[model samples]
Target: MAWNTLTCAALARNASRRLHHRALSTHPNPRPYTFHIGASWAGKPNEPHQRPKVPWPADGLIGSWRDRTLARPNRTTTSKDAGEDFFFIQEMRNQSILEGVSFGVADGVGGWVDSGVDPSLFSQALMYHSHRYSRNAWAGEPEIDPTLDYEEREQIEGWEMTPYECLDLAYGGVLREKFVQAGSSTACIISLNASSGLLRSANLGDSGFLIIRSSAVHYRQRAQTHFFNCPKQLTKLPANSGRRFSRACIDSPSEADVFETKLRDGDIVIAYTDGLSDNVFPSEMVTICSLVARAGGTEEEQVQAIADRIVEYARQCMKNKNRVSPFERDAARQGMFFRGGKPDDVTVVVAIVHETS
Candidate 1:
């Protein structure tokens, strides 16, 4: 051992003194600890959990729209169907009646085709009627009313109706034609009110709409699915079916899940069917949109690119030859038929709602 190093006996004595002190201090005069729960409770009595308020833009929102629909590649050669899906948009300028903009998309349920019914017809008719009704109603058409009872309104063709009423008219037509049992459709519609800067949205089935700001999901519709194959939808109902509206359909105005949110400049709104929603995750959508927002070009061009990218992404997912689909994992969890990305009609609508200069 070096002369400067401590001896072995000295090291053992030092270690023993530290251990003795620690043992002497342990458990001496221990007291019970009390925890108060009231101060820590986030939801206190008489006070609901509050949502952080968002500051809305003062300038109005201007929208740029792009959409695409692609048929499933797996359909048999004998089938001529292009996957029943349809949509329309209305963009209005400086006018009171038709001031803002609106758009909607509908996905036809395939079940009707098996019954010899063409779901495309229903989907197209619904979009057509909705577009027409929204045009006239927003243009300050006198005949449409928010207060009119369903029965009191005329069933005639010339009458103007509110957006919800227009949906009812479409439903009644389906019933009168006895196409209710043949098939049904899911729809998601959004109308931006120029004067108030409020976005009004109506949705059915798994089809949904989402609003993104700064590439973050600000708002989204709830997907209504009873099970994997069964989703809430607008379907055939009795004429006198006093049932009116359900969460999925509007018959007599029972009720509608109308989503209202204030949109600011640079916010993006996307409405899509299960083809895209089920296959692609929201985080992926945000990533694509973020790139679109930063890509060099005019805002219009960027917006168009965003829509194209979204549709292309969904299409690629459908045709992905390798890799297990995220959708399959979901289906398995839900006890759905095991498979890959659902091969069905794909529809996507993207609107860049921003401030008008």
Candidate 2:
């Protein structure tokens, strides 16, 4: 397939300019803010052309989570083409004035052999269901203690209800009815309660969630991926009965695994599809967050800027392949997944958490 240099250039340009604006926005009122969330996506050319159909509901102080989807070159000769990978962020309301949660999910390209199911449907189902579950979980729970240390309090509150169980219920019922008959997907979720200064997160597949606190980076994996199979833990689940259990058996150990952390005044929690994490390094992520923090902008703006830089960095990495080391190949492959002659889709969602004095 002939490479479309023009299209690649346009993609890179649009992403970079987006970062510039996000990085430069002025800080909004920091009064014990409720929450801020942002989401972005890119589609692979080989997959079916399904546009993201999730709704962006505006709540309290949380800004509207914006959406972006881009198309890439096709990989196969068949009339059924694959598109770019999709990435998205959904920032849900902090159940109480004291807590907030944000998450991002990415679906792998379904065109590849053994990719299992169509990623579009898988990603959509996971995001839609997970968000609904979080909302319900928050509603059923009692008010969180404002006096406890943020992280400690979260552990206490998180235990009362299981986000993973909520996820399981969502997945087992409607989500399964609609998509599981075909296949399953990898999913990760992250939540933060500001007043309590606690963070809760969870994952079920390769899609990852990370938290950057005071220059330290923490990585969380939702589900493990084998060369051609699902994680062992998942396959053993009782739900594995004759199902396409490739990725679903490895049940997330409770949302706590994905939801651990205490927020300082300037912590950044990022939930993203593999497209961004696959391409960018942990150190690079820290650098992007630090730049945003130092530059000074609203949490939403800083997140957008960081995400934009990540896309630009991926494009640059593609152009400078000769400089990449063999040891770095594994890391570089993440970024390359979205580039090259036949690139996969790429998507990222960034959320910055700030403490209100």
lDDT of 2 by residue, 1-357 (tens): 122334333333333223211111143423353445544444443345553343223341111222222222211123222132333333333333223454446453353224334445444445555554454334123454558643354355333333454445445543344323343455555555534556665565556667677787865454355532232121122243455444443443343243455567666666665555555567877876676556665555556656655554543443444544322555355553322322345556666665545
- What's the alpha carbon RMSD for model 1? 24.4
lDDT of all the models against the reference?
0.53, 0.46
What 10-residue stretch in candidate 2 is worst by lDDT?
16-25
Model 2 lDDT, full chain set: 0.46
So what's the TM-score on candidate 1?
Answer: 0.65
Models 1 onward score TM values of: 0.65, 0.61
lDDT of 1 by residue, 164-274 (tens): 555655556555553233447877777665544567777777778888888789888887766676667777533463533243342232244567777777777888877
Number of clashes found in candidate 2: 35
> Candidate 1: which stretches are off by over 4 Å?
1-82, 92-98, 139-166, 173-181, 237-256, 321-326, 336-339
- Model 2 TM-score, 2 decimals: 0.61
Indicate the residue-level lDDT of 60 in model 1. 18
| CA error at residue 337 for candidate 1, angstroms | 6.0
Q: Find the candidate with the highest TM-score and give its number.
A: 1
